[model samples]
Target: MPKPNEPILVALVLAAGSSRRFGSDKRLFAYNGTPLLQRSLVIPIQLGLATTVVLKPTDELFLPSLLGCYLHHPLLKVVYADDALLGMGHSLSAGIRSILQSSKSVEGALVFLADMPSLEVKTVRDIIRRFDSNKIVVPTYMATNGSLKAGHPVLFSRPWLKQLQKLSGDNGAKELLKKNPENIINVALDDKGIFLDIDHPAEVPGAKT
Candidate 1:
């Protein structure tokens, strides 16, 4: 449960991608003894937030991992995207729509990617703490050249929920972000996990069995 009177924030995990670049079902890849899809949701569950995971309708392979990690968990929900093959935006829209249909008291949703298992719990909490009803919270990191780069997972406030539902195609929310530049707040972080994702087996640290 959330603190006494804190507004509820839903954590939406998008896992419906085809993973064409990863050469196999990337969500099933193991990370620290847990499948990456399940591992990526650890912080959200730990935070006591209402969580939903978006998966492709035909993705039966992810079930074992998802059930092993969050089966019957009160705060966790699983949703499937029928149009997932169309793009990330469709999956995102499906996740958000599921939350909206299931919960009426949610203040917003913290969108996460299933392959990004390296994000720390602290980073997730910090972003949630900074989220408000009017602004979007995005994480950023410093690059090798001293330049800053944006990263995930991003928190979308309630006001944008409808617009988020309309998102489709491969661009996801990039166009929405560009159109609402004034409403976005970038939180700088010292962690590089925000930018690191396990796209291939070779890219996963300690992948050796």
Candidate 2:
């Protein structure tokens, strides 16, 4: 629970991608013993965060079957992006718009990618703990080749939500972050899961048949 006057935050799981590169519905792809999206959502649900999952308008036909009890979880809400096929920006904008209209007192939102199930629970918690109402908190990790890489579930403060809502095309929030370099606070994390996202079938190790 937040202290008196502390900013309230929410989580936005972006699962509306068309998965053109994956050649199938990657969200439903079996990872370990669960669907990929379910794996990505476990940490947030476990943390009891008020989360909104953004999906394509067409997902209504099968989401209930894919998500099972997750659809009924108290902390979760689902919103569909009618223009999701337009690109990631449309999905992101729809999710942010839904957050703005919700009754919750949200001062920030952590944007998560549903394909990145490898992200650790501790990494998500650490990012939430480092949140600021005026700056974007992004996790950074060192790669095996000694290069620094920025990873997802990027925290965007309230001040930037409007910008996110106005986004268009497939670029998502890349341009916003690029233009406001000073507003980004990169927290270094030792976990490589931050950089792991299953974009191809070959990436899922120990995947269930």
Work out the TM-score per prediction.
Answer: 0.95, 0.95
Model 2 weakest lDDT span, ten residues long: 1-10
lDDT of 1 by residue, 24-91 (tens): 77877778778888787788888888889898877655476555747678988889899999999999
In candidate 1 the C-alpha lDDT for residue 205 amounts to 77
Candidate 2 lDDT by residue in tens digits, 1-209: 45677568888999998888999888889888789888877988887778899998789989775677697888999999999999999999999999998855689999999999788999988998898989999999987888779989899999999899999899999999999999999989988788799889899888864
lDDT of 2 at 164: 99
Candidate 1 regions exceeding 4 Å error are: 60-62
lDDT of residue 73 for candidate 1: 81
RMSD of 2: 1.5
